[model samples]
Target: MSYMDFPSFSLVGSFYTDPSTMDNDPSHYDESCTNPSPWQDPGGSHFFSFQDILASKPNRAFTPPVVTCAFDQNGNPSLTDPLIGAPVNSTDTPGATNGQTPPFSPAKMVDLDVYQQGVSNIYGFVLKLTVGGTVLTGAMDPCTLNSIRFDRVLPTRGWAGWDSYGWGSFGGDSNACGVYQSVVRIPADTWPAASGSPILDQLRAATTQDTSGNLLLSIRMTLDGYQNVPWHASDFRIGRVLATVGPQLATDPSHCLAGRWLAGRSAGPGDAWDQPSLYGAPFEVKNNTVAIDLSNALMTSAPGQGPLNLGNLSVYIGDGSTGVVGTPFQTNDILYSLSGGIVRLPLTAEQAAAAASAPFFLASSLPGINGLSTFNKQPVLWQESATGFWIACDDRNFQLASDQPNPGSQPGFFYVTQWGQPVTDASQIEHHVFPCFPNNSAATVPWSGGYKGNSLSSDGCLEAVLCPGTHSGQFCLELSAIWDPGSRTPELESQLYFICLWQKGTPPPPPNLESGCPPQEQMMSAVVWSSYQINTKPDWAEIQRLMKVYVKLFPSMHARMDLSDQQTFQIFSTNPPWFVSYANMPGPATYTLPSGGVIASGTIPYYMTRTIDDPRLMPIMRDLSPNRLLTVLYYCYNLQQETQPTPPPPGEGAPHPTATPTRKGANA
Candidate 1:
């Protein structure tokens, strides 16, 4: 959707038509209402939705829309002094409440009611209640409004007709004169760019005020309890506009943060409220704030960069140009680079608008927590639009772990809340108690992996139900891989669960075992491969033994491994064969000898048969040993143990125990 389509209201600075004073229209009354109206509206001319009109709070009285106030012969609005229990259409006080008191009271002091709840992606208002007052000058929390209410109303069928489409409620301490600034959140793409753009000054200027700086007649009456305003209040001054950068806010303090709301995707498999998906924790970005601190937000790490860490991020703002070759992707308006983990954005109105309406991204040159380092450019995938940015899961080489049979089979990429390990038992998997986003329905994929299909199916979008869970005793795969890096060393660790496994049901069984070695021989080959095998051609008997061993491990691995079209291992092949690590093998890699002289890189393949004939391999043979084959894997496991993220403190129960008899090999 175009950024201009965002949902927002511009102030004309007018007062709302009083609901209590409106004439009765029975056709607009909902049948479920305690008291239905008597008249029918054949043309649907009634302003408010029947249900909304009928569902007035018990503390408030319901009224219908009618021409209670019309232009006088002189074209002035008919006026009346404030009077308690005044009647509508009263000859003496026309358009007054029809013997029913309005919910507001002018005598009571009216102040902006600020809710301090956490932020969210839902569209909301942040009005500057009072310019300089102690209570009014602060920012109103947009996260307070729980939900939006939409109703159809036609007021003159013009600009005013756009006024009261959505309604929302906040349950908390509120006085008769307290004014709430509720947000009617729509999807970020549908919301008006003004919601987060530099249109605040223009909107604030649009509001009409009296000579003494007080609001005009209509707003004064509404705030004074003469009328109850429904829908977007055009005259309200929006507070410093803020939006989220990711799909959701983390509510648990132990994991990321709580009470700091971010607005992003409300639909998708990863949008579980309690267990935030691995797209990372959502964070806030506000307009006109000059500098933004992203150390606490999820903006640091991009796809392939691995998990974020302090002092490693570089921030960039898109220049509002279609990305093309030879064109600069980033804007020079970034006055300050990331320092102390904060990025200073352009402060001017025009620059800020261009920056927000275009793409915004973060890049880091440092190696990620996974220990993989790359020299390729990390592309920008997010646009800091009016409300929030979008995030797409990059499954790397592990597409089968997603709901799709392969990449591109469906829409959205799956986001794993837990990775690298299995949940172990059914009871250990945390269930989404309130809602579950439907699989394959996502906005966009920020970065490309193997996922190529883009079918935004409206049908299976956001589903609110109990998510699927695994039954006890079911086996799941946890595949790990080494990404394409500039270099791979024994000091670096391999990424575990590079593709999160499908953990919701019984794992698919291994392929049928081919004619091969006996069980005892198979066990020996498996032990050799895991503990001592080097990258070399094995004997014919050993090849059969390895095949037999793979039979035990391939089932779990087949669904989790991202390989070429070939589904089976190449154990019998004479070409470069697979091993835990090729470090001890000779290949394109250059090596420095113990004498401090470097061995020029080899052009020959690394397998025992392939490299034995290459004269350049003579020097490296001195370093080759059965023990060297295990060193790389041993160090990788050690680094993984040292770098594991600290487990969150125990909750209400004992931590789940890990299961045994883990799967092995390419396929079993």
Candidate 2:
């Protein structure tokens, strides 16, 4: 939607009008209202004093279009005595009950009466309340040198119809009071800049006026009460304004901040975030903040750079002509170049309107977070604005585990979460998960190894749900990738339901959370992280032998293996693949290292977080997932360990308690 087209009376300011016609371009402008009106409007118009009009809290009986007071036949307004409950309009005025009258007693106090709440692309918008008129021609008392300075209104930014009180601009008589009226002429463009520039070179403001001659901006703030004009208010202030660089303030005065709130978006799949699809996916849009992986375009260790860190990359959006180089409007005039690649420069629609070129750039440091080494940083993907998400500055990490020591090793679930790994959303497993566990050398050719086999359907859960499966054993994958830079080794882990597999109707034995894998309680269980061999490739012959033997061992188990999923890029092609440390065996990659082979690229990195530990959640396992982990272990990977792993370190559960099959390639 063209968000600018949105209509709202949310802002207030002053504009210009032709004094001769008494018409204003921007209608409904009202202002400061400190005193009561004493002089008649002379035009015989309905009258309401400024202070009486705003006496109520707002949204009360005083519907604040505020009655205009009549000017005396001489144009001079008098502030003699305070007028109370003077017939505002013939039919309205709320009265206080219980004999408890309020100060200067307003008819009523409105509760959130006119301030509506809703999302708007437009932020930091300014408006006018009333347009003052200029002294075109008027009768006057003879002017002395002291009378030279008159109370005549003058034009602002040029427009006799809508003007400001000029300095030494008014002339003619001192008592000079004549018919006060002006022609209405709204600006062709509502924004200060008809072009809608993202950066404001200057403060755009307006002045509100009350019949008592008090001029205010008419800004409505919950706290600090209704401040008089000339004082810096939160939303519209001339002095130190109050505002956050983040999204629009939900409450009245949270963000009167100077920095603009920018948008974010994913550059593409080439910039895969290091975490697995199950969790820690670099892409997120929440609380008006956007986070997307930008590794492809800015990774220091990317193709040619060796061991170099970008040191908080900088990403940009907008024309870049007027904004200070490397500074986010969100920042209180702080320079971005000062922030190591951590802080993000948010781009807003206003900036877009005045953009000179495509506004897209990367940052080395994430915005807000500071003072940290970037070596172990999770492929830094701060706010990618297109989504309008908000990530607190203090919430970002300062340090992480170093490069993977053994890129092929599986670092159990316990170790993974211990180091503060990010978790992925479950529903996107197939689209965002699975591809991380591709077939290592066993597939004979890396080109076809990444999920291109004939045994199972060639899709993840996104397609798995579409593929026909046994009604009783249907399951979806839920797995995680744990990378411990201490070992420079990363392992893919899966859950174990083979231990709990039984006929659909019969309930399994009580879960043993103390030892072995946690109990699988639901029909649709998550894909527990598991691997065939921690650091080596499984032979196809050995895989076939294991699969055949398992099927023969449990003839009615109806186990199925899916091999095509091991193929990298089957679901999505991205740069800096999920495995940033390891090289692809014989697949597409930006760099091919003679020592490590291929660096996996062009994919997502993050797996879903398992909910086995939450006491309140006991999903019926049989209904949610397919019987696929075993088939995966037999045909695609080798089980990590024979005995159930015990302790804070996640060890593997036995393949089966009763059987030990023979395979020459098997270590056990």
Candidate 3:
């Protein structure tokens, strides 16, 4: 049997044989019940004793060796030592020839048993081992065999050291020397090596079309460890640890699949994830029907209908009521529908009650349909019927009816309704009526003395007057008359002529003396007053009267008259007349009449001529008194007497009775 070390005594009693009930115990079992006794079977298929089993298993027990490790000056383990004995070098020998050192030299021993025993006694036994490329050394208690490390490097890359181990000189003693051992185990796998490669590969292939194929092969190995692991149960929390790491590892691939998953699900026969149908289809109840998919039916049909068949239903998914139909009944309407199927329109209670109570069709006809009555007994027909409906007379109808008038007879008055008579063509209706004149026919005369009845002579003096021989007269008449009978009117004669008449001779004068008259009396005749009629035919005086009338008729008329010397008797009517007197005087005539009816004749003496100069005369000779007329005649007589020359008598050489030179006093 192998020796076993019992560290904790709680497991010790199983090794010894039991004293009681020995006959039935395995140690006391019959030889027949045991194969090769209780410890052995034909092929060792029997239960092994605890000690034998311990001996057969690989040595899991750690026994510290008596190690006397020595340090060199650099604090490394030394090969040679004086007090502790040298390590035995297997290559060295004990006996040698020619003074060569022995293989097992006493001073250079590779295995120093004596020093090792001394080391065990001095401190404690210690064990040294190498694991995962790191060296660990531990001291053990002599009784407990438990480890107390002085210097060790763990497989996880942690270190421990002691103050007495020379690790102080290496600057590790302060950190390593503690009651709790400072042990660092180098990890078998690093985070970067385990996770970085897979993560990076997934990220790189995330854009590839065959990411699923690539990712499946790549990630299968990392996840396989948890294939049979139960949730929330493991030593060292391996499953939990893997679970935590799994999501981190899957972040890239999971993110890549997210968009594709959403797109694929959205492209199926259902509403997109972001939208929903608001109305659903009607339900059909039938026997033998199982459950129905309302979500799909809700998507495909109108609201208020439900329980449709799953095959006929569509997926309803999205934000709530996005595709809702039926005019979205208001909250009030919805409440009303829930209560009952009655819809209340927006009518007020009063209006509804009034409408319910009133008789229908009583006021149905339009307003103002009745015929309107005027103040008189006439009906105004303010409303009229068009087809079957009556229309009130609006302002347009009233205005039209007001404008209508009755036909009436035309009055005898000129009415200008259209264009006026054309003033431009008025000359066609013009008439040349004979314009009447006073004292003359309306006959046109030629330039000569005959009447052409159409033309008037240019020389004829025509006066257009308004005197009509009656009150209102004709206008613009021409008259032809001789101006002077003595010669042709001076205006008509261009030449000047002289005329000579016979003068009385003194011969045989006067029939040889008159009765009792003196010889001189017979010769010089007394002045006799003879009335010579100035035959002014065609009566220029009358013409003058007519001209005066003309001037009165037309205030703008003015004329100038000229008379010849031979026609001295021509009367002129002017406010003031210019007169000439023949006296051998250089000035105008001045005469004073004598009182009483006396006639005196004499040549105007030079002394009396001054008295007669510049005499004032009345404009109308008839207006003068007889005394004044006598005075004028007396002046003429006096002027004749004064200028008389002695003439020879009739037979005695005196002037003849009628030959006194006509007693011309002064030509005025």
Which has the greatest TM-score?
Answer: 1
| Model 3 lDDT at residue 19 | 10
Residue-wise lDDT of candidate 1 within 542-653, one digit each (tens)?
A: 3333223112222222232211222222211212212222323322322222223222211111221122222222111112222232232232222223343223223613
Please, what are the lDDT tens digits per residue for candidate 2 over residues 305-368?
2112334344344333434234422221121111111132334444444332232333344432
Candidate order, TM-score descending: 1, 2, 3
Tell me, by lDDT, which candidate is best: 1
Deviation of model 3 at 354, angstroms = 91
Runs of candidate 2 with Cα error greater than 4 angstroms are 1-315, 318-359, 363-611, 614-668
RMSD of 3: 83.3
Ranking by lDDT: 1, 2, 3
TM-score of each: 0.19, 0.18, 0.09
- Between prediction 2 and prediction 3, the one with superior lDDT is 2
lDDT of all predictions: 0.21, 0.20, 0.17
Show where candidate 3 strays beyond 4 Å.
1-464, 467-641, 644-668
- Prediction 1 TM-score vs. true: 0.19
lDDT of 2 at 314: 44
Displacement of the residue 109 alpha carbon in candidate 3, Å: 99
Model 2 quality (TM-score): 0.18
Candidate 1 displacement at residue 313 in angstroms: 2.4
- Give the winner by TM-score: 2 or 3: 2
